[model samples]
Target: MAAPEPATATATSSPRPSMRWRVVDIVIASVLGVAGGLVFVLWNLAYNPVTAPLEAFLPGLQALFHGVWLFPGVLVALIVRKPGAALYGEIVAASASVLISGTEWGPLTLLSGLVQGLGAELVLAILLYKAWGLVPAIVAGAGAGVGMVVLDLIVWYPGAAVEFAMIYAVSGILSGAVFAGLGSWLIMRGLARTGALSRFAAGRELGSRAES
Candidate 1:
């Protein structure tokens, strides 16, 4: 099959919207970033308590929950459809989380967020920000997952067993694809339906679908 892309058709005769950031874009993007950070803060608080048993049961099962940290970048990119949206959202969210809840990694959490955001951002760039459908979301999430696991392995699982590495990697990808990718897509759909996203193309895409 061909590489995945969204079918966000625009009129050939119409001018394409500028990719430059708008004030509204920044505001909405910040809202998403803060929201994502709140989720991250909650996950951070619960992580050890939740993952201790899982790690004991299976060394890498905790990676399954890693997706909880991945969606903000993607959700921002989809909604904003602009360059750096994913990275900006991810960093803002990480900053908020650190300021509020502080992680074991301290300020290094920002670096992790940057990597994850780049993971999603790179995919969007590859597609030239033209695709925002399910496949693109999943692919972007998968990209973020890869970034997450690479950093994780380097920092947390260094000198770990091959089996652990393999499991962690696969689980991370799956988690991102589901929680970050599919999760964000579903959230966008709901937001569109509620008209909260009416100012965005994502929302317009939903409207076009319903009308058809």
Candidate 2:
């Protein structure tokens, strides 16, 4: 029998992801979106009741929930590293929430999701689709936070006090950093540890470090 050719070793040995979209990726993204949406729904349901006192006392605390919806979108973008990943995940989540529980905002919720997702998406895009460091992730979260606030203030809280608005905005940015940025980073790290994301950039970076 002819001898089989020996595999050549190179400085880098990461395999290319298949050109076609993997079922696992789609399934994971979908599941994450749905789960994130469920969280948004629950949060929204509980928000008014939970924050009513705060809203009455402070007048802008209720807007914090706006940025909560951006977490899953950022997570999906960081994991998928594909164009529209953030937008799709965010839109799916918002749509799911709206479908499950009707909102007076009507179609504007979808628009907010689109803008907020784009905010995070642009940050990842500026990173040249390469680095997924904590700084960039946090920046993406902040961007989404700012985007949501801009939309909400203009549409819903136009008459809110400047101090209230500032507090609301800051709270949203903080939430985005904690929930979307830190939380998503942790999830990615966990996924990398499990070897499930071995095909993505985040996985490769963590994998290389683990090997070393």
Evaluated with lDDT, which candidate comes out highest? Answer: 1
State the local distance difference test value for candidate 1: 0.91
Residue pairs with backbone atoms closer than 3 Å in model 1 (clashes): none
- Residue-level lDDT tens digits of model 1 in 1-212: 98755554554356776799999899999999999999998888799999899889988988898998999999999999999999998999998898888666756799999999999999999999999999999999999999999999998789989999999999898999999999999998999999898899999989999999
Model 2, poorest ten-residue lDDT window? 11-20
Give model 2's TM-score versus the native structure.
0.80
Candidate closest to the true structure, highest TM-score:
1
Estimate the lDDT of model 2. Answer: 0.78
